[model samples]
Target: MGTGNTNWKKDFDKAVALHKKAINGDKQAAQKAYETLKNIKFQVNNHSLVEAYFGSSSALIARDSTDLTDKTNYAKRGMKALDQAIKLDGNNVEIRMLRGNVAYRLPEVYFKRTKTAIEDFQYLIKAFEGNNRDISKEQYYEILLKLGASYKTVGNSQRAEETWNKLLSLNNSKYKTLVEKAKSTGGE
Candidate 1:
């Protein structure tokens, strides 16, 4: 379905921008990004990146939906896409990030996504050890912060403490205030 000689690269960039806006709370951007990413997915020959963006857009739609049915349905669709994306390219950092972020937010009782979140975050932490360029230092910082919370959510307090300690050791100046508060309150 790569018809009309679609400039998929441009579409991908545009949709990614829209997805970022959607993440920042723009409903219209979410809708447009979802549609564009969904369309680009079918048009692209390779699915790894396309599917990741589509999955992220699906999560956005789920987050913005008012109806519980729509919300759950979209979330399920997004999870499937994320699984497929990871299967296509397990080492892709952005895919892992998207999936981890979505899984971390899902209700564990209903979605059973906590383990997936943990796995993805762990993979990301390992990925950070090398020449990984798919994500940024800030993103890694956020990942460390959330990884600790996620461990706590699953009752793994020791792992949580280790993760938070790792984050604290980073001593990122941009997150100084947050780091100070976290230090005082143990990032709970």
Candidate 2:
């Protein structure tokens, strides 16, 4: 096999071992493994490793369960690491999707203070620019759903509705599900 396949197998094996160790309560080993995987240079797609980083960051945030104030910083660090992954391989759909997810989960108050959440969401929009039309459509609807959800969380009901409508226009499977969900919930 070529280097691409070889490196991916190595990363996959390490990721599995790390997750097993984490499940067995080896927190330090788990963290070290996740960091190593995140830093691994792979010719194959590295989206899974990047997502593993997000999972580890989320785990770290959860460990500090008492500190809501610090959770935002945890999210910020995850965003930076995800951004680095995106810089390395910007075309990976999963990386862009995970970046969108990080933006969507951020608290509204913190987002208002620094606007980082909005910037992150905008980055998702930019990530799809100039892709093939079919892929573009799929990503466009995903962004609309995420943006609509974020705006609703932030109390921008009007913008959320607009985004929902744009998503409905695509008539894709997921967007259709979302449109019906919105209608049932009175357009949130």
Candidate 3:
């Protein structure tokens, strides 16, 4: 697919905004967003298209449905979409974060993929370490927090502590308290 569209960025941003709203529990809005994303006829770059699929999948998962099977199916679809996104852009921090967050939240009964989350976070950590300037300060802090949490989830308390310590050293004003709290609690 050609990546020539100048408006793709705007469309991608709009879809992401709707996806965020859906994630925050707006079922109707999520459905609408999913529809809009799905209906986009223009060919976008793989990265943008992957994000659109991810957004659609998120909306599906966020949609209210009473059936357990339906919920599971939706989640599975989302995971598949995320997997595709990751495959499309293996080093994309945003794609990795999306999969990491989804895997981290999955229940043990539903194929808990916490290890996958840890792997993704670690990849991000390594990438950031190699080139800190590749991402913004806010993004760096967010990755550190997620990496720490993922480490803790995988029972690597020492690594988690180390990661949290690094986060504290960053002195991110917005998340300093959060990092301190997590650190104080040993990344519980």
In lDDT terms, which candidate is top?
Answer: 1
lDDT per residue, candidate 1, 143-176, as tens digits? 8887887787787879887887788788776655
lDDT per residue, candidate 2, 1-188, as tens digits? Answer: 12445555666567657655754667665566556555553444445444545444444443444576566665666666666666766566555555556555555555541233345555666666655333466667767776777766666779878878877876677678887776566433
Score candidate 2 by lDDT: 0.59
Output the better candidate (1/3) by lDDT: 1
The lDDT, on a scale of 0 to 1, for candidate 3 is: 0.68
Q: Note the clash tally of each candidate.
A: 0, 0, 0
Pick the winner on TM-score between candidates 1 and 2.
1
Q: Is candidate 1 or candidate 3 better by TM-score?
A: 1
Per-residue error for 29 in candidate 1, Å, reads 0.4
Stretches of candidate 1 exceeding 4 Å from the true structure: 1-6, 173-188
Q: Residue 26 lDDT in model 3?
A: 78
Model 2 misplaced stretches (Cα beyond 4 Å): 1-9, 12-73, 83-94, 110-129, 133-140, 172-177, 180-188
- Cα deviation at 138, candidate 1, in Å, is 1.5
- Candidate 3 worst ten-residue window by lDDT: 39-48
Model 3, 1-188: lDDT tens digits are: 54576665566567678777877887776676666555453455455354535544552554466788877776777677777777777777777767876776665346567787778877777877788566666777877887787677667889888888888887767777887676676453
Instruction: Kindly report which residue stretches of model 3 are placed more than 4 angstroms away from their true locations once superposed.
Output: 2-13, 40-48, 51-56, 63-66, 132-134, 173-176, 183-188
